[model samples]
Each structure stands twice: as C-alpha cells, then as structure tokens.
Target: MNSKSRVVVWSTGGVGSIAIDAIRHRPDLELVGVWVHSADKVGRDAGELAGGTALGIAATDDAEALIGLRPDCVVYAASGPERDAGAVPDYLRLLGEGINVVSTSSTSLVYPPSYFHPEWRKQLESAAEAGGASFYASGVFPGFGSDQLALLLATQSKTIRTLTVREIALNDHYPVADVMMDGMGFGRPLEFEPMLSTPGFIEMAWSAPIQLIAKALGAQVLQIRGSLDRRVTDRDLEVAFGTIAAGTCGAVCTRAAGVVDGREAIVVEHIIRMARDVAPDWKTSDSDATYQVDIDGDPDIHCSLTLGDAEGHGAGRGAMAATAMRVVNAVPYVVDAAPGLLSSLDLPITLPRNVLE
Candidate 1:
C-alpha cells in the first residue's frame, strides 16, 4: 500500500473507456497503458478515447508492450461471440506475467470456484500461482446483481425458501448496433436465433450466478435449467439500433434456475424490452435499468435497485459507469488478494466514496 498501483486498461470499447476515466479520478491508482485491437485507435490519447480531456498515455495494440510495463493490474473488458476463447488467452498471459486482472468479459469468473471450464480453471489457477497474480471477472447483471447482491440480501433471512435476482432493462436507450441487432435479435424476425436464443447459451451465460448463490446457501446444484421467451411488437418500432417490425420479435425474457434439494431454489432472470410499450405483460423497471432481489422466505425481503442519472432518468451511461467502476474500484483489493483466481466470495470489495454520479 506504500505506492500507487500502476494499471493498464485493455480495450477502449464500452466499459474500458469508463474504466479509463474512473482510474483518473482515483488518486491511489495510475494509468500506465491501454490495449486496443483497432488500428484507428492505435496512437490515440487515452483521454481522447475515453471521451474526456487528454491524458499523456496513448493506446497501443502491442500486447507485450503493455506486459512489459509491469502494471499491477489490467482491466480486461474485451468481449465477443465466444467470450472464454477470446478472454482466456489474454488472462493467461497477464496472470503469467505476475499482473492481476479485473475483467467484465467472462461472467462465469464472477465466482471462480464455479467457473464453467474445468481444464482452463486449473490452468488459470496454476498460471496465477506461478506468477503471483490474481484474476477476477464481474459485471453489473451477470456479475454483482446475480451473485454477490443476491447473497448479500440473503443475510437478512433466517429461513430461506427461494432466491431470485431479476434484471429488468429498457434497452431503447442503448444504441449498440451489433448487440441490439445480432446479439439480442432485437430487430430480427421470430424465426431468427440470436446469441441469447442459441441452444445452451442462456445456461452458459447465467448458470454461474445461480450455482454460486446455491453453493453459498450450503447446497449443490443438481441441475441448471434455462428458458427463453420472445414476444413480437404489434406495430413498427423505432429503436436506437434499428427498427423492430410489427410482426418481428421485440422483447425477450430469459431465465436460468438452479435445482437445489430437489427444488428450484436459485434463479437469475432478465426482462428486456426494446421499447417501453413493447412488453406490458412482463415485469418492468422503475428506471432505465433495475436489479431487484426477491427472497421468498421468512421475513421475505424485496429490494429494488434502480440506476438513474442526476435528471432522475435511468440512463444507460450510468449503468456503464457502474460496470466499469465495479472492477476499477476493485483493483486495490485484487492486488492485495492471494495469488489465484479470486471471486466475490474471496476478496473484500471496496466502495470509493469519491466516485461521481
């Protein structure tokens, strides 16, 4: 703790940009480098990429160059079709270099012990141990709200029946083209199958949270079940990404539940809408995005957390900042944690009081 932790931001897309800005606001951390895959961003200033004032640091495509910097940690936020395939290699090299990593890409790593890949899990642990580093992955929905937040709310219950984490997001404000169209099938016909609708995708994406919460409650998951329901818009819908035809799919509700003690005990569900008027029958959020935890047990507790801006509107930017800060703020804890795969269960999470709205 005597010296500031030198940090590097991997990727300037999405959460990475916000991580760069969040790092600058913290006095205890230093931005050393940024890694990007795009050519146009190769020599751009870090601050410019983050949509802020100029920072002397420049973004680079060189992996070894950043590795050579010997940063205390790296915020890995690069995401794609096969997240594990693209992220694992980078994580291995970073951990092997004795540098810790806080990531938003691999959702399963939110709980290290329950990582989906058994072989890669051992390799990650070995590499981390060899280099004396740690690796943690988290995000707002698949990360904190699904696992840590649900378990946190459970502390108030003496007798537990069922635990559920619901994410109700209004996606109209989010304008990511690839995600909105191809990833979520927002503008596609009912016959189209996007990543969210692909077989085993829901379980792969969400089972970790369900199983993590199950294990914490002293039970093993006998099975994990996934379900997806998509509804079509009644009329032509205009969205930030594109248009949702009247007869095309416009909304989706996906759920993953863990069977514990011969019952469905832990569940993580997402209720997403391209427009507010698209899904009236489904659960809705007060703000643009809401993470609600429902504990159906003794002294049942229902807590609703809505992300909003200063203007009282739930904006997507606020959620992006939160996701970035989740890992950026955890850098100090990850750096001091034991050299291995750390999880929400392993490290003491910190909340910086100085973070802005």
Candidate 2:
C-alpha cells in the first residue's frame, strides 16, 4: 500500500481548524504536526485545539520543532489582513526546508506574479526552487469559488464583454474580531479610515482575481480602480465578535474594477455587514451569504453559490469551512507540482479525496 503524505497544519483559527479536521480524517494523508501561534495552545492535542476530538498529536509554538518533523506539506492558515511582516519569512523558511506549502493567509499570493512585488515574488520562487518544493495560495473568494470558477463557466461563451463577481455576506456571526473591526473598519466611527478605505487598497487586495479573470478571458487590463462606502448602525448590535454601538460603522460596500480599453471589464464587489438591516439599499442574495458571478456576452451566464450548513452550521462557519477545504484539497496536487510559485490557473483540478467515508 502506498504511504500517506505527511502533513502539518499551521495555526488553529477558523480556517485552520477545518484544515485539521480534513487532514485527520483523510485516509491518504497523515497528520504529523501542528504549529500554533499562542503559547497557551502549546502541548494541547491538535484535534482539541481545533474544536474536535483529541488526535494525540500535540500543538507546539516551536517552529524549529515543527520543521524538524519534516512534514511533506504545510497547510498555512495564518491571518494576513494587514500583511503580517513575519509571514514571508515564515513561508520562506518552510519552503527552503523543502516542504510544499498551501496557504489561505495571503490572498494576493493566489497569483503572486500578477499582483505581488517583483522582488518578493522572486524571493519566494527562489526559496521554492532551492528547497525543491512548491507554494500555492488560495481561498474561497480570491481562490477557486470566485474568479477561477467564473472563468471556468465562461468557457462556453463565444464572446465576452464583461465579468463581475460579488460577495454579499451577513457577517454578524463571523467570529474574527480583528478582521471585522480593524481590517474592515467595522464598528468604527463613520469618519474613521479603515485599511480598506486607503487608495488602491481594494485594487491591491483584489488584483489577483481581476488579473486572473482577465488572463483567462485573454483581455488586456489597462488600469484598476477602487471604491468604498459604509453605513452606520441605528441601534446597538450584538455579534459573535462583540457589541457594536449605535452610530458606529455597521455595513461596508467596496469594489475593485479592472479596466480594459477604457471600460470596466472585470469587477469584484463585496457587501458585508454586522446586521442585515444596516445596508438595506445594497444588493444582496436571497440566502444569508452568496457569491454571484455574471458574465455579459454572447449567451451571458450567471451563477450564484451559497455556503453554510442550513441544518446547523451558520453561513459564516460554512464559508470558513469552504475556505479551509479549498486549500486542504489542493495539498496533494501542490505537493506533486514542480518547485515554484503556482496559481489556480496552473494547478490541475483538485477535488476532495476520501471525504465521503
């Protein structure tokens, strides 16, 4: 019998927890180690840390120890909203050690060459080559479920004029405080400038998707533009993260548009809120949270995708699970790929393995 691929999961946040669950249950993969960011998490069972049953493998904050295990691949689920300075070096160290990496941390890394700084791209590529390993970044939005999937659906189009992908999420139940309050400026005063408001911020964040879609459609992007708007809460709201006082920022609407020949040929739009009633004017899906893609051309196509377990798991939780699964399912393919940075465009179809059993 073929030996299972040894894997390690980095971090234990929302997405990380899902990766751990998938790895532990997969018959073709073996959970070898887990890297934790918090000292308190050290020595705890990996499964327990991820909100599951004990898996016997203890989590550790010691990077050296985790690297020493020589895991075949690392499922990196660390946060990257503010572009954590330590992320690059950490990824380099792991890649340089010859461990293939699949991550959801840096969304831009989904198609690094297209959006990343040339110097940083070269550095990561060099590290991957030196270690004889590969690196791939992915997530539900910037990864397969949005731009990539939209492109796939566009294959039937005889001619295409424009493409737009929109994510409308009711984020009250999303538990990441930093992402909601800090990164997105949620619960802040209306005048406060959040990271997403900075000029070119949305463009930079959604560049990969824009560029990927353009490339797939064989369109030349001349420029990219960004826009942002927010709404205030009329009453105090309680969410998984914390309380949001009335008069604070409650809803956010942002867009990044890729222009081709003076037209907005491709666009990525996000409509997020702490309460459903906050942004009544903004367009939304019938479901709690939905990703919709519209292709305008010969035989225009429209697709809507909803995540979450309606039976129990909230849409927020389901979105997190989908993000994790997107990276986890790509592990084997990424491990077998040639050493270098890879994008969704380059990877073969990666489907979940041993999932039903």
Candidate 3:
C-alpha cells in the first residue's frame, strides 16, 4: 500500500480548525501534528478543537517541537493581521527546513513575484531552493473563488473587456474580533482610520487577484488604484464578536482596480456589513454572504457563489471552511510541484479528495 502523506496543521483558528478537520478525514493524508498559538489550546486534542470528535493528535504551542517532527507538508492557516514580521520568518524557516507549505495566512503571497517586495521574495526563493521545498499561498477570495474561477470562466468568452469580482459578506456572523472589529474598524467611530484604509492597504491586499486576472488575460497592469468607504448604523446591534452601537461604523465598502492602457481592466470589490440592513443601498448576494464575478464582454457573464450551511454552520463559518478547504485541496499539487514559490496560475486544477465519499 502507498504511504499517506504526512501533514501538520499549523494554528487552529477560524481557518486552521477547518484544515485540521480536512487533514484528519482524508484517506491519502496523515495528521501528524498541530501547532497552536494559545496556551489554553496547547494540550487539547486536534479533532476536538476543530469542532469534531477527538483525534489522537494533540496541539502544541511550541513551534520548534512541531518542526522537529519533519512532516512532509505543513498546512499553514494562521491569521495575518499585523503578523508580517513574524509570519514571513516562520514561512522561511519552514521552507528552509525542507518542508513544503500550503498556506492561507498571507493573501499577498498568492502572487508574490508580481506584487511582493523584492527583498522578501528573494529570501523566500533562496530558502525554497536551498531546502528543496515548495511554497504556495492561497485563500478562498484571492485563491480560487476570485482569480482562478474568473480565469476559467473567461475561457468561454468570445471577447473580453472588463472583469469585476465582489465579495459581499455579513460581518455580524464573523467571529474574529481582531479581523472584524479591529482590522476592519467595523464598530469604531466613522472618522477612525481602520487598518484597511491605511495607504496602499487595499492595493496590497487585493493586488494578487487583480494581477492574476490581468496576467491571465495577457494584459499589463500599468497602475493599481484603490478606494475605501464606510457607513454608520442607526441602532445597536449584537453580533458574534460583540456589540456595535448606534452612530458607529457598521459597514465597509472597498475596491482595488487594475488599470491597463489608461482603462480599468480588472477590479476586486468587498462590501462587508455588520448587518444586512446597514448596506441596503449597496449590492448584496442572494444569500447572507456571497462571492460574485461579473464579466463585461461579448457574452457578458455573471457568476455567484454562496457557501454556508442552511441548517448547521452559518455563512461566516462556512466561508472560513471554504477558505481552509481551498488550501487543503491544493496540498497534493503543491507537494509534487518544483521547489519554489507557486501561484494559482502555475498550479494544475485542484479538487477536493474523497469529498463525495
């Protein structure tokens, strides 16, 4: 019998927990270790922590201990707000140790060579070459649902003019306080500058998708521009994270556009709200949280994707699952790839294993 691929799940948060569940259930993969950041989760069973039955594996906060196990691949699902200083080194260390990586921690790394700083890119490239390991970064939005899926749909078009991808989500159901409240400034004063509004923040965050789409279409992006706007709530609202009182920031609309030859050729927009009613004037999905792609071409195509459990996991949790699964499903392809940084454009079509069974 062929041996299963040894894997370790790094972190167990919104996305990491889902990755743990995926690794544990896959027949072709073996869950060897789990890395945690919190002291409270250090000794807990990986399965139990991931909202599933107990698995034999235990979680640990010690990064060195997990690295010592020398797993074939590491599924990196750590959160990425204000973590660049530490996260980049961690990725380099893992790659330098000859362990391949499939990660959702850094969206910018989705197409690093095109958008990331040259110094950081050089470090990662040298590490992967020296260790003979590969690194691939992805997530639901910057990964498949936006870039890859849009490119696939474009293949059917007779002519192409412009493409726009939008992510409309109800943040009330999203549980991450650091991301929803702090990073997004969801409940802050209207005048406050959330992390997303910082200069170049939107361009950096959404550059991967814009670049990916622009490259796929053989278009050179001459410039990238971004915009951010927000709305205040009229009433106090309770959410999974906390409470958003009246007269506070309750919704955010942001967009990054890629310009080619003095025209906006590709764009990625995010319309997120603490409640459905907060952004009633803005476009929304048919479901609570939706990803929509619109193509303005000869055929003029529009695609919408909604992932959530109508009966079980809510839209927020379901979106997290989709993000985690996108990384998990790419593990095999990443593992077999040549040693270096990889983008969705370079990878083969990846599908979930044993999803039907």
Candidate 4:
C-alpha cells in the first residue's frame, strides 16, 4: 500500500482522454500504459492523445499486451459493449491476472447495492477473491448528479411517498456522431429505434442511474419507457461550430418508473436537446443554459442547478474525470467490499463538496 500503484488506461475516447488526464494528475497512480482501439493511435504518446505534452506512456491497441504489463490497477474508459456485457468479464480477466480495476463505464455503479449484472458481479467477485483484486465504476452526470443527488435527497425524507429525477443537458459532443444522429432522430433517414441504445443519448446513459436511485429508495422498478424527437433544418443553418441543415435539432425523452408497496414511488426522466430553451409546455426559461433537479417527498423539496457559459459546459468534462478519480481512489475500499453487486449506498462514502476540488 505504501508504493505508488501502476495503472493502465484501456481507451482514448473523450472519457478515456479525460481519465488519462486525471490519472496523470494523481501522484499515487502511475500511468504506465494506455490502450486505444484504433490502429492509427497505436504508437502515439498518451499525453499527446490527451492534449498534453509527451508523458512517455504509449497508446497501444493490444488489450492482451497491456494485460501482460501487470499493472496493479487498470482504469478502463472503454464503453458500449464492454459496459453492457464485457465489464465484469474484463474485470475478471484482469483480476485473474492480479490487476485491480476502476472504470467509467457503468455510470450508476456508485449507487444502490443491486444496480448491476448479477452474474457479472458474481464473476468479478469470484475473480477478485481468487486474485485479490478490486473493481469499481462511475462517471459524469449519470454517475454523480442523478444517482448521488437523488440519494442525498432521500436522506431528508421520513415517509417518502414518491421520487422524481430529471436531467437536462445541452452543448455536449461525442466521438460517435452517427449514434448521436440516430438517437436524436437526425442523421437517420427514418426514425427507427428509441434513444435507449444510441450513444451520446442521455436517456440511454441515464438508465443505470435511474435504477440506482430506485433501488436506494427501495422501489421495485415496474417499467421503463423512452422516446425521442428532432427538428430538421429546412435549409442549412449556420452556427459558431459549423453549418447545420435547418433541421438538425436533437432531442430525447426517457422515463423509468418503480413501485414501492404497490404505489408508484419512483420515476426518473432524462431530456437532451439542442434548442435555445425548453418548449413552453415543459416550463423552462428562454434564457441561457441550466440544470434543474426537483425532489418531491412528504416535505416536498426542490433544487435547481444552472450552468451558463462555456465554463459551465466545460465543467462536465472535469466532472466526468473527477467522478472516475474519486471512485478509483476508493479502490482499496472496493477491494474489501462484500461479494455480489454493490453501490455507493452500500459503502461508507463522504461525497466531497466538489468531486474534483
């Protein structure tokens, strides 16, 4: 425990890049290696890929090769399939090789004791037990404000009748633009699937967090539903970043519901859009960017969070990294966690006033 831990980063996407930056800033962690899925980035320096100067860590696509480096811990920023079906298995493989893990994949991994793949949890637990390693996961708005915020509000309630969580975000970008287009009902020639499975869609990303809050509040999820709509540019519309067709307005709506003792006690909503303000019916100001969270209980509570300038939107990147860093730093605690799925509520955690500060 006295020695600095050697760590490997498993991807170089936005989350991965931010994670590498956060890792480099940590004195206790040594970023000895990085893994990228692209062949083009194989020989590049991790620092360069992360928008920093050369840090001597090379990016390689060889997952098995990085595994051979025998890092004490691996910070996985890889997403998608890895998050859904491969997270626990990948953790198990690394644990089997005596490597601990912290990831930004499972956003709601931090709350409610049961918000995970049960079988996967068992696999990770068995592997960790056999190899004496640890695994943890968290990130961004999904990781923090939703799960953590809801859980925090639950503490003020005595006889909680119902819980509602809503998340809104604008001015966000992702590497996967096609997924974004499809999810937003944009680039696609036709609207096919809901936003549930598309990348960069908050609805898809918010599911676990909603589940986390529900489980923490002891609500049994009855059903989950989602929807999406977009406004296509009639003509090419020009913006600061680039020109978009008059159409290109991306929007999504999602909801998850749960029942407590046959009463609908929990509902979560996520809304993502690219408009000046929410429509009049949704009841949002026609002003600058903002965020809001309203918690209704026996006492009836309400909270609103707003972010205005570039700095406000930029805060999300740092927020994402900070969530991962905080969760990663708790690897030792994760190592001692009981078998099976776990959450922030399952552990003794003092959420720092500002995750990165």
TM-scores, one per candidate: 0.94, 0.94, 0.93, 0.78
Candidate 1, residues 278-354, lDDT tens digits: the string is 77888876578889999999979999888877443755877888888889988988898889998777777556645
Encode model 3's per-residue lDDT on 276-304: one tens digit a residue: 78968889665667888899998999998
Score residue 257 of candidate 1 by CA lDDT: 87
- lDDT per residue for candidate 2 within 1-357, as digits (tens), equals 235789999999889998998898898899999999889999999999889999999999999998999998999988755553667888899999999999988888887768557777888889998999999888888786666789888988998788889998887877778888878988899888888887778888888889888887778887899999899999999998999999999999999999998999899998997877888989866566788899899999999888776542278778888889888988888888888999888888788788874
Candidate 2 segments whose C-alpha is farther than 4 A from its true place: 1-3, 80-84, 175-178, 311-313
lDDT of each: 0.86, 0.86, 0.85, 0.62
Report the error of model 4 at residue 90, Å. 2.4
lDDT of 2: 0.86
Stretches > 4 Å off in candidate 3: 1-3, 176-178, 310-313
Q: What is the lDDT of residue 353 in candidate 3?
A: 73
Per-structure clash totals for the candidates: 0, 0, 0, 9
Highest TM-score scorer:
1
Residue 91 lDDT in candidate 2: 88
